[model samples]
Target: MEMLSTISGWIWNPLAYVALGIGVLFTLLTKGVQFRRFPDMIRHLRSGGATEGGLSSLQTLALSLSSRIGVGSIAGVATAVAAGGPGALVWMVITALLGSTCAYAESVLAQVYKRREHGEDRGGMPYYIKYGLKAPWLATIVAVATLIGYGFVFPGVQANNIASSAELAFGVDGQVVGVLIAVVLGVVVLGGTRRIVKVVEAIVPFLAVGYILSALVIIGMNITKVPDAVVLIVSSATGKDQVFGGIVGYAVAWGVRRAVFASATGLGEGTFVAAAATTTHPGKQGIIQAFSIYIDILLICTASGLLLVVTGAYNVKDPAGGFLVEHVPGAVAGPNFMQEAIDSSLPGWGAVFVAIAVAMFAFTSMVFFFYVAQTNLVFLLGERRSKVLEAVVKAGAPAIAFIGSSVTADAMWAAGDIGYGILGWLNMACVLLLTPVVRKVIRDYDRQRREGLDPHFDPGPLGIKGAEYWETQKEPVKEPDRV
Candidate 1:
């Protein structure tokens, strides 16, 4: 336990924080593509249903969001404030604004390098890393690591939180909930990606919109306190808020860490769905992914943070393992912060409501983990892969969730942190290496739109190769490959 905590802290504090600058650089280099394409992204959201054995663009978007908006947006936010204080919220907002560009780059690249697999469009960090960087070894490393980290470790965190929250809110047996979660998830997951996509397409919108509306109601009730909370967040971030002065450094680090954890901008998980989308242009799905970054951080993460901070249903713990301040006495932090925040506002039924909401939110994330694991297993096995390996992973995934019910919340979160930290760093490096390819995709996409033509990816005409699924029998158009 001690070792896990130490490793997780080391990765999140200095390593993840420095790596965040890469996203900021991407935002600047793209000249803020996320903002420029904002309206176009909204229009693209109309896409849905299955075709050509792949998820529709909108379903893919929901799949990506469902995978992202898990315990991180709820429990993870509370953990950040507990460790880093209110100032951390300010850094989270900053991370989202900048990280959108990084999200755009990776999502488009995934679409560009994707391959047709299992009669469906499927690709991810591994596909882009291998095809774009031409480093199959590194790609293999990432695939296996992702299979372990997300497939095993991160799902444990979500499961653990679900158990803990349900037990606290409704007096249900955490063990029973774990089994039920495993059974339900196994059913959906065994149905394959299509079923998962179909369900998440329904589940994501309901949970997200419902949570947003609940947040707005809480915020409206305490609307007058909103301004001061925002002010305090900014002040604490800049070291100008004397109340949180001593912890500004922790605030900045934890804020950015929590945002990365919640928004998943650089974690490479987004590519799983991005590569599976049936979109006309790779950049179109990329733009939609950019919007998801904002949705997770700007919308969900902030909602969780504001709900706690405005109501003073929050507490902070110093690194010395002592309370820095206690706004909510005896709250014990973590998911309890959000539960108590809602409970304080609405009383009796609040805890039960949040518990049900979290169960659905976390269940969606659990489903994604299995798909990711299966995807990587398929990648490692190539054509020689068998159902035996698939069955083993399928059983192992839910088993971890079951065991996680008995584990401590902090330990599970720490394990997940370590997984995401390593994967996020590796994926970011790969994106940086593939800069020219992403630049070319963007140039081609933008040129078509400017010419008043509907933009579609034509790698042959654009003089790019290694896009296995995108290749055509048509002759390549000779053009200088300059992006």
Candidate 2:
């Protein structure tokens, strides 16, 4: 545990600044496309239709959201508040707003550099780094890192959270919950990517909507306390609040760290799923992906933060030891904080409600995690598929999920942080190096929109090479139906 924490600290201590800088840089390079193309994001989201082998824009959104809006939204928000105070919530919102641009840049590059594999579109940081930059070695490193991170290290965190929440909600044992999660996940994962996509597309909306509505009910019930909660968040974030003024640095650090962990702006998680979409233009998919950051941090994470603050159901821990603020004296930082918040308003329901929500959210996220790992596995073995290697990932993912549920949350979280930090470092470097390519693509996309024509990608004329998939295309891919 100590070693894991040490590694995590080494990776993440400077990562927040790195992530922020890249986000700011991308925003400038793209001329703030996340904001300027806000309307187009919405229109293009509905415009993209899926071909026989690819996902529609909305389906890709759901797959990405499945990973984005998982335990991070609930349990991650609780940890941020407990460690960084309500002020952390403010920084989380800031990270998402800026990071949305990073999301746009990476997603655009992913689409531009995508390749067809096994009759399905497959691309991401690895593909772009390999094909776009012509560095197969660096791409191999990225693919291996992604496979290890998403496949083995990260799933445990989600599984740990789900098991802990379930154990708290019901008296079920962690091992039992772990086994159940592995079994359920195995059934879906064995069915491959299409099954995973269909399942996520069905459940992501319901999970998001249901969780948000519950938050609204809690907020509406405590309408009188809303202003005070908002004030606490703002003042604490700026080091103005009397109670939380001392740890303003911690607020920014934890908020940005947790927000990046939650929304995965530049980590290349969304880039993999984004590359799987069938869209007219790379920018359209990029814009849709940017909007997902809003759904994740702006709506879902905010809901979690508000639930904790308004109800005073959280305990703030001082990094130096002891409590800075302890609204719930015995409660540690986790989903229980939100569960307690819900219970404060609706008796006997918080644990059960949070348990179910976390289960579904974590489950969908685990599925997406497997897809990311599988995608990278394919990238690693280009034109050489090994059944033994495939079976290892197929079986190992669920095995880790089960093991994660039975272990301590602290260890799992530390491991997850290290994985995210490493991926961020690798993918960010690739994104920054390829900024010129992204810039040209964005300009092309913007020019077509301004000319009153739906954008179509033709990489050759733009001097963008390595987009072999788009180079052969003459017109936009046809849509199957709106979904």
Per-residue lDDT of candidate 2, residues 273-365 (tens digit): 999999878888999999999999999999999989999999998878899888887775888898899999998999999999999999999
Candidate 2 lDDT at 229 equals 92
TM per candidate comes to 0.95, 0.98
Query: Residue pairs in steric clash, candidate 1?
Result: none
Best by TM-score: 2
- Candidate 1 lDDT, tens digit per residue, 311-411? 88888886777687888887756778888888887997668877887888888998888888888887888767587878888887788889888787767
Clashes of each: 0, 0
Candidate 1's TM-score reads 0.95
Residue 313's lDDT within candidate 1 is 84
Candidate 2: regions farther than 4 A off: 474-476
